[model samples]
Target: MTEEIKIQAQILTNEVCQFTVDRPILPKRSAFFSQKEDAKGSPLPEALFAIDNVVAVLISGSVVKVTKTNDEQWMPIAKQIGAAIRKQIQSGQPLVAEEDVRRSASEIDLRKKVETILNNEINPLIAQHGGVVSLIDVRGADLYLQLGGGCQGCGMADVTLRQGIEASIRRALPEVEEVLDVTDHAAGTNPFYSPTKK
Candidate 1:
């Protein structure tokens, strides 16, 4: 007998709602889709794109993080998303097409590419603020990054990560599924920008 498709919703932020499935949905690498066209191989995200207000989809492990373009209530949209994902899983269709299987490059090569972009594009820009970003690890399609100096405890770090660093990585290397910041702000010795300051 097939396992029941059970889904639970957790709100990540005002705009992002995460739906967790009882079963695994995707591979270890997270697939981040900003637009419908970018969701080529994944049937789950394609179905999610059909929903009216979904602006982005991130399929990581058993969780599907959906970002809404509008500020609608999460309850209604979560229900719709839960049902859509359940339907797709029950149908037994391939979540990702065989032709679209993500090609894995050597970890060394991937790390080098990410570092080069950071050194050339991202690091130089953030350096002006006394911040430096280091590539911590490259596992599968995930890129773990460490932020130091000014970026460690800055109020704008999250914004910078989402808008600046992530966009740059995605634009440069489409295969990189996720760019995660692993900085421990509590240990930050010197923070260039403080949130409490007026």
Candidate 2:
């Protein structure tokens, strides 16, 4: 008998919900399946795409973020997703195939390079403003970052990311097509340029 897999679902947005299982699914690299073809050798994404209304599947750090096609309620869909993920895990299928791992090995190197630039170059520059930047994840040619400290909710955050950070990343790694800021500015505790500041 297959061991029962427990999953917890959390709504991230109106159309996106994150489902986490008790065990680690994908620890190192994240796999994104915007379509069934993208799933390829990954049993998890392929299983997830089989479900109705699951437009995309992103597995990273033991969590699967499922994006629905429309603004449907998450309660009903999340239940189905949770069950599917449980079944998929219990099947003992590989999360990512050996071939796929070899294919994405270069991306790991690229991610490390990006992290080095952030630590050595970008972070120091932002530190002067009482701010810091962190590399969240790298998907394909896109780099996701989170800005913290004084830069979190600052009005100049966008300008800094677009003109300064993005430019710097692009210059360093021309292969990186985009550098996106995933920081939640509204939740920022300390902003360098808050309008309410005296």
Clashes of each: 0, 0
The global C-alpha lDDT for each of the candidates, from Candidate 1 onward, is: 0.81, 0.81
- Indicate the TM-score of model 2: 0.57
Estimate candidate 2's RMSD in Å: 7.4
State the lDDT of candidate 2 residue by residue for 1-198, as single tens digits.
667788889888887898888878877766655567767777777778888888877777688889887767788888888888887777778876656555455656777898898899999989998999987666778888999999999989998889988888889889998788899999999888886655
RMSD of each: 10.2, 7.4
Candidate 2 weakest ten by summed lDDT? 98-107
Error of 1 at 3 (Å): 3.8
Backbone clashes (count) for model 2: 0
Residue pairs that clash (backbone atoms under 3 angstroms), model 1: none
lDDT of 2 at 165: 86
After superposing candidate 1 on the true structure, give the runs of residues whose Cα lies further than 4 Å from its correct spot.
98-198
lDDT of 1 by residue, 1-198 (tens): 877788989998778898988888875755556678767767988899898888877676798889996568888888889989998999899875543335323454687798899999999999999999987667667988889998998888888888999998999899888788899977887787677847
How much lDDT does candidate 1 score?
0.81
